[model samples]
Target: MVEPGPTTPTSPATPTDPATPTNPTNPTPAPVASPVATNGKLQVVGNQIQNQNGVAVQLKGMSLFWSQWGGAFYNASVVNSLADNWKVTVVRAAMGVEEGGYLTNPAAEKARVKTVVDAAIAKGIYVIIDWHDHNATQHTAQAKAFFTEMAQLYKNTPNVIFEIFNEPDYESWNEVRAYAVEIIGAIRGVGAPNLVVVGTPTWSQGVDAAASNPITQYPNVAYTLHFYAGTHGQWLRDRADAALSKGIALFVTEFGTCDASGNGNLKLDETGRWIDFMNSRKLSWANWSLHDKPETASALVPGASTTGNWPDSALTPSGAFIKQKLLQ
Candidate 1:
């Protein structure tokens, strides 16, 4: 749904060369190490994500909205502000891969991603390099190439988690699983030990289906479950519970405090219930975005500055509410 129209089917493009004036986007180099190393590298064990010391880790963070449209906010200063003030420890970079995105302008998209990734590296916080595609099954070749480059570029950085597919629409679990295995193999082939999270069917709400049969035999692999509290309710929770009962690790990479449409009123009641569930399970989660889009889910108001450190008046109702919760 992120893409208004379907992109033409095409193979994966070549990975960007890390060394060049046109180097891919990345964070600046700051001497201070963030939670990423201070706590330790993250790994998967059973249904939980473990820190370097093998302690269970739960990250409360924000996800930058679709990269193509929200690229303006993926800067080092924004990341620094979020980490230093917002109490966020993990950031997901939602790289747009379709519609006039990666396929149409690979260089621009890659640079945008590198900008965020490099900033995250400098900040020393964990980051998710998300292939923000709904029709990822149709772009397997491109995914392989992109992830390969990502793995090799940050093989030494365990903070990099690869989300090969954002939301898989209409694609069956069988199809999604196959694509994930292939992509996971590509990342592993590059000798990158970072974690890889695969999206489930039905816009990543089909966690139970993925749990029934998952992509095992790969280390640090997990599944994605997204929700918009105003729309997704008990039915979604039951599915997530089923996946957990089956020992499947789950990460809520993209979620909104509003309706699934990314607009309308905020559902505080349902949102609280979802938050309680995630808290009880110690599951990591990231809010929908850092964009200033004119919507209830958009945390910032129109005309808000692109740089981090916004005034309280610039926050929307949902932003104010979520920030309070994050501060807790």
Candidate 2:
């Protein structure tokens, strides 16, 4: 989880201008094929994410910045651009859980997430309802309530995926795994079989540790493996390989082309290597962010249109690189 500082912008005392869904007049080109329409419900079959037919699948997409600060991009127009222009198969709504987020103003924060989820569903793409909290173990009650409601609402929808925890900072795998069992129980208890992604310890880099002791009660569950190309190198990939050897499914829910600070010089070489690794392994992923904040991770330039139809001038170096990969 990003702290309220230079790397992660702080939110206002309260959200006075939350975003609502709107159909812009000049939208991007329409997407021809729907990933969800083709793949149907995704399942974990032997360390891989597969469609309903048991064929392996890889989903590449963008993750919206924290809902509290980057709420402008939570509308349907952004989702349309990602699906149509960016060629993304999935989108992640990282709803901030602290600061002036869900804990303080549940109604406003949740509305932003619902807008994204509903938009992704309408566009026939997969959506990850991420609980963007670092200290999720302390907020177990709130997390359970939020996911329980989400499961109940989208129980039958195959386009939804629940990320119970974004990144666990200092929590051990045992602590994180226990918290996941309860939240996964909450989601499964509602009869929602949508894929559930759980974060690992040490800012989601402890796949090796999670592999040592994995969750057994859940079906269609996978562990998150987050990385920033600049900070995490082959060492992390080796750890992931070891985890994969243990027969646990892995997903790159959040990644950056720059350092972990969310602002720094672009590491294109490392980013390329990471991309090649994910592609070779068929590991599904979502880019770190889709906002225009002044950071290496933010994809768009400042003052870029909140609506779709972004031209080349509107993209940052990181944005252009990520778009190029998604288009491929």
Candidates in order, TM-scores: namely 0.91, 0.92
> Which runs in model 2 stand beyond 4 Å of their true positions?
1-32
**What's the C-alpha lDDT at position 285 in model 2?**
95
Q: Candidate 1 at 148: error in angstroms?
A: 0.2
- For model 2, residues 1-328, the per-residue Cα lDDT tens digits are 3353443342322323343333322222223468987898899988999998999999999998888788777788889889889999999999989977799889877888888887887788999999999999999999999999888877788888999999999999999999999999999998889999999999999999888898999899999999998789999999999999999999999999998988886898999999999999999999988988888887888878777679999999999999999998
Error of 2 at 271 (Å): 0.3
- Per-residue lDDT of 189-307 in model 1, one digit per residue for the tens? 97878888899999999999999998886889989999999889999999899899899899999888888888886898898899899988989999987778777787888767677
Model 2, position 58: C-alpha lDDT score:
98
